[model samples]
Target: MMVSYHHKNSGQFEDICVADLDYAFTNVTLPDREGRWCVGVAEGKIVEIVEGDRLNAQHVWHLDGKLLTPGLVDAHTHIDKAFTAESLGDVFAQSGLASAIQAVRHLKSQFTIADIKQRATQALQWSIAAGTTAIRTNVEADAFVELRAVEGLLDVQRSLSDQIDIQLVAFPQEGWFAIPETLESGASTYVEQALQHGIKVIGGNVNQGLWSSNPEAQVDALFDLALRYNCDLDLHLDNWDSAEAFTLPYVAQKTIEHHYQGRVAVSHIASLIHVSDSQAQVAIELLKQAEISVTVLPTRIKLTRVAELLEAGLNVVCGTDNLRDPFIRYGDADLLKALFLLAQLTGYMANRDLERLWQTISNNAAKMLRLPYGINVGNLADLVVFDAYSIPEAILHQATRLAVFKSGKLVAGTMQDQVLSLHKPDFMSPRRWT
Candidate 1:
């Protein structure tokens, strides 16, 4: 599936100028722009992005109309949880609660570690199909049973790096406080080990499983550990329909108070939807102040809505947390669906601001995950082109991630042999663009 000839550039052409796209996007991190241009790429570095016809060189490509932008980075995720959720029965169904209860009740003899791996691989494939280049995955870690689950996700992360970038977080789904056992060998310590081995963040869950003292306390403990290690904090906060969850001002408050330098993110927190209007406004203000980021799994969060979060201008990011497991039944992994849904639900497309909420999946996500070179010159040439002529069209249709390039090399394309094929490309994994 070589990209269409339109994406190629002949250095000899007058319209083509070669340099890094970074120069073109100093203000905006990702070059989500449209124009007639050709980007000369080499050694995975974008040598230039300049107006030109096309390069006529052995290693040159001429790209036109299509915008060359940075690969997407997911702000928050639970790699294993998402992978396993898809197979664990459909939580979105009306009888979801009963089904999950039954599944858990019958889970004693039927499940094996290999099963988790299978589910994770399935989910990773879905993400690759959707153009997600990186993710901050929460893994199971706490006592031995759940810890084993997280560890298994860690293995999956390693296995799928060529297609997706993963930041494994050793997360304690159960409480660290009540899971008194965790105090002895808590997930944070495991986080230390995981980080040394490439895990990027420290993660925790509040009001669930072990040590259910206070939600804030759980997050604080994880934040403290993160600060100690100089790592990022990714917490799964109140994920229910209970307004009583987290008391007054939840994730946003802590994020601002802590003023933590490293990344601090809250995943789910659907309970925030139930927060009071006045309080929600305050939380949103605080969140912007702290620069705290969020990840919203549309397929999962749609099960519940934190309307206040949406109203507070805290646009929930679209993520496909679960692939094909218990929590989720089917998985599309296409963010365009999620983004379109978000725009419709939150009125994100009311004005030119369509690009505003668009950040939920693109630029905002990049900031949350802390990728300095996600899409820049002198970096891996990972990029995605869409079937949109204008920004508004891109948002209205939530456009297609029609083409994918790795190392300035097209790996997937909608069209055949042309610089960019306009046809919808096949969602094939490990594809080499001809």
Candidate 2:
């Protein structure tokens, strides 16, 4: 019993092929664009995007006007230490950053490559299912852990390269120069080794008296390594809850001096929220001049003045910092949940604001990582179709990802037997109060 059907009102038969890209999406709305279009993907790239309901492929998915966006990007996460909260208990779960660091220190020596791989792989799988096609995770690199986390993450990266794009940062959770073990090389030496071994980015912590007694020296050391290794720099700076923990301006100055504009990213910067508007304005302008991107982790710490930074025309993106770790006892490695919390915290309720905020997890994050992103012809076909018509609707409902594609292949979510199904759930409906 063979069933033959023409593609809608076009009165043309669809071409069939036995390949991964032998599918087309019709009646799908692109973000911030009017009307629906048929997007044709082939050979891991977007080939055609025409304004009509045409199949043009073997398999046709009539989205019925669902929003199709580029796959989400989690720019900053500690996947090396993800899913470790249950074993440590509630005391460290709610504790401050110092206590969380202490707790991890006690357990770092016991972390094997296999254990790290198991936990990080699970977190990555959850992220992929949630529509994240790319991520930049920080791996701890210090005397105690040495390069164990880096080695484990490299293995996971290679294993999951087909499903998602993973970038690793050789991060020194403790200060680079504050090692007590004379038997091992300094943190800087280990970071370079990770870079030599295949890490493309260098990470630092600039909390002044905490991460490093001399923040300027630490910044110099990081920049030196980054320049020498020809890698990008990502730093954890001013994450403390005090205005006095100010090293952003210095970091910005260094970026300009080193001619490393657009090659550096800073996370947290929570102290910016405590500083005065005038001081914050100065710092924001410096960041803009340095072309440095700011990644805000809403789940892990109080957000900086996000609205003000965006108003200053600074590149401000968001990330999921931790997943069930000591620092953030609650996380699922889902950027939508992180975005929901960010929207609520920043009061981004307007339509325009929601659309712009959506970019934090998609376009902005990609731009920060220098990835070629978006739903356009010639771009990589890493896209997600959500069960919502508009950006605001998607964010408001934390919309279900109807289908997730990586390199033109279905990696997560539904898309199988989708067009043939008669029984479909109403994913757009909200819960009723009655």
Candidate 3:
């Protein structure tokens, strides 16, 4: 059944022929061992999913049998942080890592909304170019409310809404507990305040530095607020090196205790990555049972590896965290780099794990963002078509995204061999709760 569906993003997607459809549409689900073989997008949503026919479209584009995974969803990031970080300096532009840091350190006080807007725009555009459809970036609200970051990204969202997807994970980047714990100061109340202004609360990885007050109490307070606001949770936990930084079990326990439905995302759960084999296994089980997900920033982790943790089976999703910013430098919001690094580190770039790895960048990440459960239709009608047919080959060879569409609109595509790509696949990196 060929249905006519179109979007301003993908352009006039009409009379799509399903004669060459590869996979069965009835089983709309996360990519299995076989992966999403073929999809039928109609009316800005997947409508007619056919089993097999090679589903040639009348006015159609072919994926060349490449793995047809769902669009990417970056579960965690510091986009707003990137905004503040960018104004500090052209960290990436300066090849000298030391020079970049020095420059950024000097300008820490120079960060402004104008700088944020420019940097945010550049970051979002860079992410879009990397096949990420959706991304959740943390925005820090200082005393001034640096609303420009929100306004700039929101404008990017609206402008690229047809092509990219984004979630404003308005986060208090600094620390909720660090500001003297004064309700009058508003540091402790920042998360709630951001939520009040329509910002979703992303939890913090309260362990060291700011968490000096009392890690357990700080964490419990975050959980309590997340439960109270009924919003998603993402945190900057154990971002660097630290063995005692593991709070997954505690966080999971709190989630269960709260009986919360909102998602929990932990960035740089690097602590678990360093745990012993036995402990890692136990932690994985606990995380799985608690329905918690982890986002591992590849570049950052590369700067800080705990060994064998990559070998341990954990639901770790790769991310481009703190790109060209203060903390860690150089990442153009490229999940490709993250995926490549994941393969190098986890040794999962071989057979099934290779395919599974792709899911973390797309399907799994989208699920974490609660896409399937929300208004996920009519979203730019974008698709990432690879030049390769075999999943393993597609990844091994760094298969180019032959074509990228938004709302059925062509955003980026190769001329000779159609390689699908998107500016921000959804402005994100994929890893999900399910």
* Candidate 1 wrongly placed segments (more than 4 Å): 1-34, 59-64, 81-102, 105-114, 144-147, 179-198, 208-212, 247-257, 301-316, 373-376, 398-400, 414-416, 419-434
Report the Cα lDDT for candidate 2. Answer: 0.83
The local distance difference test score of each candidate is: 0.57, 0.83, 0.57
Candidate 2 off by > 4 Å? 1-21, 93-100, 179-186, 417-434
lDDT (C-alpha) at residue 54 in model 3: 38
lDDT of 2 by residue, 33-135 (tens): 7888988776676766778785457677888777789999999999998888776777553776566666777778778899999999999999999999999
TM-score of each: 0.75, 0.90, 0.75
Q: Which candidate achieves the best TM-score against the true structure?
A: 2
Roughly what TM-score does model 2 have, to 2 decimal places?
A: 0.90
lDDT of 3 by residue, 1-434 (tens): 55454454557665554553332222222244343333555445554554443344434443333444455567667675564544544555554644553454345335565666677777877776666677777766534354445555555556667767778766555456644542212344655666776766555646553344555676788877876787778777665456677666677677767765347767666666565767767766666666666676667544323233334444556667776666655677877667777777766645667777776677657666766521133343455555454555556666565555554455665523232333334312222112
Worst window of 10 by summed lDDT in candidate 3: 425-434
Cα lDDT tens digits for candidate 1, 376-420: 434566777666544455556566767666555555556333454
Each model's total of backbone clashes:
49, 0, 57
Cα lDDT for residue 213, candidate 3: 57
